[model samples]
Target: MTSIALITGASGGIGRGLARQLSAQGLRVAAVGRDVDRLADVEATLRIVADTTTPEGAALALETCVRELGAAPTQLAHCVGTTLIAPLHRTRPDVYRELIRVNLDSAVYMLQAWLAALKGAPGSAVFASSVVARIGVANHEAIAAAKGGVEALVRSAAATYAAQGVRINAVAPGMTETPMTAGLLNLPAVREGAGRQYPLGGVQTADQVADVLNWLLGDGASRLTGQIIAVDGGFTTVRPLVK
Candidate 1:
């Protein structure tokens, strides 16, 4: 029997990478995203289109997946997020609200909507957090706050669902190379500065992050829960300037 995995925000970036990796691992993937066209191209067994930022949208997405897939997902990965970079003083309240809704609220809604199916399947659930959850960065007020909430939620979900055999964890990545960061990487100075700042001398790729996520959802990480793994290319542990 093939294990089923449901991934939110599967249209692009880390989410899309994870969907591809999971499918390659022989897990049937249910790719969910707001872009139907992009989701359709994911090469998964099923595609679901939903905003995921609202309770109703999440519920409908979960319902559609369960009804169409013929089995509860054995793994759930919430990879949908939004970033609003601005100094605290300059950040608007609406920006904060939207970031929270996208990063934190979506995770909560997706987990809650599929909690039953996940528990029934004895699954593992992973959330995409950021290194900002533990470290501070300039112009990261909104996203940091939202991801911090995600970290806390991961711990709570792990604890609350342990008895039900559902494992919950998070992956916190640092400056990754994706379409979202393509513009920054295009600037030679910015790219060089970012590269020099990491002990590994460069940013991570979406495939690297996706690899960790795949491990967490697979049987290899069956004993892990409530853990926050940092796939940061040593950025979290190194202080190049200090060295």
Candidate 2:
């Protein structure tokens, strides 16, 4: 049987990059997203339009991929998330809920759907997390809370399915150059300040993060599970205090 890969939020920077790389590797890639037009631009064998944040939508996307690809996806990459920069007290309830829905809830639903479709077959899943989820980043309470839940879910689900041959992992990246962070990085001052926080002294690109994620979903990472790999430029682990 042919191996298939499914990527959610495929229209986004990281997702699009991942889809292209995976497709280049000759795995039948199913790119799932809400935008039909944008998805068409992705290098995927199948472009599926679905929310994947809702249970029904997630299920539908997986089912559609299995039907179209002639096999369940052996690899899953969930790049669906949103960012928010606001302190808790000042954060509105609706905004928090939306962040949770898009960032955390989407991962939960998509993972569940992926596992259900696998039906005991071995597979792997990788999720997009944030460095803020690991450290205390002021004005990022809402986004932190949402991504924190995602990290927790990753660990718990990884433990739950490891014995069944399913591996789950996440990558918590520092400020990345994606559309979600465009507004912050568009300003030269803000971009330089953000880059300085990382010990590596630069913002990561979507393709850079996607490279790590691709490994997590492949056979090389077969022994890895329940691990949150930080793709940040030592922002989470090092103190680049000297500026």
All predictions: root-mean-square deviation over Cα? Answer: 1.4, 1.0
Candidate 2 — which residues are off by over 4 angstroms?
241-243
The digit string of per-residue lDDT tens for model 2 on 1-243 reads 668999999999899999989988888899999989988789999999999889999999999998988889989999999898878999988988899999988999999999999999999999999999999999999999899999999999999999989999999988899887898899999999998888888899999999999999998988999999999989888888773
All candidates' lDDT scores?
Answer: 0.88, 0.92
How does each model score on TM-score?
0.96, 0.98
